[model samples]
Target chain A: MRRIMVCVKRVVDYNVRIRVKPDGTGVVLDGVKMSVNPFDEIALEEALRIKERGEADEVVAVSIGPDDAQQQLRTALAMGADRAILVKTTDVVEPLAAAQVFLTLVQKEQPQLVILGKQAIDDDAAQTGQMLAALWDRPQATFASKVELAGAAALVTREVDAGLETIEVDLPAVVTTDLRLNEPRYVKLPDIMKAKKKPLDVVELASTGVSAGETLKSVLVEPPKPRSKGVMVKDVAGLVDALKKKGLL
Target chain B: MATVLIVGEHDGSKLNPSTARCVTCAAQISGAEVHVALFGADLAAVAPQAAALKGVTKVLSVANPANAHPLAAVLAPQVVALAGPYTHVLGPSTTFGKDLMPRVAALLGVPQVSDAMSVDGPYKFKRPTYAGNAIVTVEAPESRKLVATVRTASFEAAPQGGQAAVEAVAVSVPLPTHTRFVSVSAANSDRPDLQTAAKVVSGGRALGSKENFQLIYSLADRMGAAVGASRAAVDAGYASNELQVGQTGKIIAPELYVAIGISGAIQHLTGIKDARTIVAINKDAEAPIFEIADYGLVGDLFQILPELEKSLA
Candidate 1:
């Protein structure tokens, strides 16, 4: 039986307007709400697709954050993961350290294939999957738009600048899902109820011997001034002339 | 002292124009000894170009058959292994760089800073967040080394002066087992590379249809600028996904950026935050783009674009 692990992150829903606090330490999510990151939901979909096809025997969803992140795990479970693991940490973990926690979880889970969103919505540093592959000394692929099971290995199509490139790698590899990978499914009310009863194992980051103190040394965040209004041009010719006059053409 | 490893992007025999810009960024961060690593089958043909870039003290050429087609998975580990001695690794924020560097940083147990515009200290770097709407400075403390992908347009490609000595390093790395490139289909366009272009012309959903995007193309061609589009335009099928520029799409920072019929959303603004000058042309005077535009024009883009094209002609 093949074991697949999908990493999920709880983030401020993409639709919300996230404001960075003046302290630059955390974002102020006042009226805005949070949810599982969109890309990670795509990752979860890919994992479920593999399982639905019988390519894998079991699918597990994992997340590293505070207890509130369990919501994301439940979201993944509702999407069809067999179970979930929540590596509880205080606040957000730096990208590298988060990768370390992922490495530890991978060691414990021993899944044949690991998948993650290309990057997190909040940090936007798509490094965890790559770092996990490196630390485990496993072959890895990033930004995969498609993945197919080929014998004991996986054939993946990755999106690049020029076009798509297909690669075949052995199993027990790390793959990061991109936006083009697959459309994630919406959790039906029935599945949402089932997810609440699904088994969720919570582990503390300190238990893994990884210190968060040395995680984020230098951190800065600032909010951009809101855009006011835009001006419309009359037509193409006029727009061109206007831009030229402004030295922007 | 921590050494810095800078990856050089080249087409077999020639280094990319942005390679120098990455080298300059490496030089800015203290405790860094810059080493340029060139990978491909045609290292000898590419060596001279890598040697010509200033601030590159040493060049390591990895020639192998597996490297003929560059992929992030194949290149990430090699970068991590070569980064053994360096405290920081730097690469240009091109598609290849952006795809590979973060993976490399993750492999080496270091935090990877993506699209950083400035570096304040050894591990502290400032990068645009929220698509360029705001800036965030971050520090990676756990790992001894730091990896940063520099926005090419934000830094000037350093002048070529001193010729560095090139060393032929045999490709000792194991062959990539998981993935291999089957083929690549390149799109031929008259526009410059969007990430490095000095000027960019973008359109939005207000253009209404795919045919209308021709106005953006014409203006871009007239100005010799790259073409871009808002997410709404791309989703509306007015332009290709490759042309989309927003929070969820490609980020660009050019000398000048022109937005026609785009109501600057925060997501769209994040992508163009580094552009030195911004000009917005839209029909709605109260559109969000005007607040950030250095010069704002209130008119219909359909009429303004053609006029701008004629003036340039």
Candidate 2:
């Protein structure tokens, strides 16, 4: 049976307004609620599709975040993952260390394929999946728009600046899901109830012998400031004349 | 002793403009030697282009039949092997570099830094995180080799004067058998590439229709600029997905960027933060694009663009 692991992240809900602080460290999400990132939901859908097609025997969802991330894991389970693994940490971890935790999990789980959102909504770095693939010394296909599973390998097509490029890599490789991948499915009432019974494994970050505090120098949080509003022009001709006078045209 | 290796991005015949930008960035760090490494079927054609950059001291060319195709799988191992002696590896933050740099970093068991706007200390660097909203300074643990994908627009392209000597390097690793370029159909546009273009003109949902985007293209054409679009414009079916620029879309840093009718969402700003001079034309004085813009015009882009086109004409 082919084993597949999908990584998910908990982030500020899309509906909430994000405010930047003065210091430029982080954002203010006071009244705003948090939820699973939208892109990760897409990743989960892709994995579920493979499992539904009998392309894989099992689908496992994993997250490296605070205990609150269990909510996202539960949602993944509700969507059809067979199990969940939460690499729990009290403090926020940096991308480098978070990648190490994922690598450790991969070492233990030995899944034939690994999948993750192209980027988390919070950091939006888009580094972990590619970093994890590098650390494991395995080939990776990132920003995949389409994925085709083969007997012992998979053919992945990625979006590039010049054009699309396709590559076939052996199994047990990593593939990061992009926004163009698929529209995520919503959990039904019955599946949400079934998710409560799904197996949930919580592992502490300390158990991996990786220091979250040490990995990151410090936490910098600030709200993003609003941009100044400019005047709107009524027509193209007048705006052009205005620009030409200003030498901007 | 910390040498920097730049992976050449162009087809073996010419030095990509981004490579010159990468060279300028590497030169900013003191005591770092910048060398350009070329891999492909033709080294003779690519060497002079590498040798022309101002700060580049050496040009290393690795020629093999396997490199005829530009897949990351074929290029990553060769880069890893070539990067053995250097402490830093730099590439332009384009689609190809974005795909290959991490693999090289992973091969070296180190973290790959993405979209670095500026570097402060020698090894410790400052890079944007959370989609350009915040910047972080990171210290690599004892690892000598650091891999970074440099944002092309963030740095000035290096001057061309230095006499860089070219030498051939050998590659023994076999290429992957599964991947090959079947065919490519690139959209032929008169405008410049959004990433490297010095000027860009973008539209948003306020444009009302795809036909109106011609105003953007006309103005861009007059100025020899590239065309871009907000996510809203793309979703509204006014522009192709390839032209979209935002947090989840393509990041662009042209010398001059013109935003037309865009409401200035945070996601869109993240992509254009690096543009040296931003000009915003929106009806809403409250539109966010005006905040970061170097110049602002409060008017309808529909009227502004055609007038501007006539003025340029």
**Top candidate (TM-score):** 1
TM-scores for candidates 1 onward, in order: 0.89, 0.89
Best by DockQ: 1
The Cα local distance difference test for each model comes to 0.78, 0.78
Stretch of 10 with least lDDT, candidate 2 chain B: B177-186
* TM-score for chain B considered on its own, for each of the candidates: 0.92, 0.92
Candidate 2 per-residue C-alpha lDDT over A23-70 given as tens digits, one digit per residue, 9 for 90 to 100: 755567566687888878888899889988989889999998888889
- Residue-level lDDT tens digits of model 2 in B13-49: 6667888988988987788899998888777887888
Residue B119, candidate 1: Cα error in Å is 1.9
CAPRI tier for the interface of model 1:
acceptable
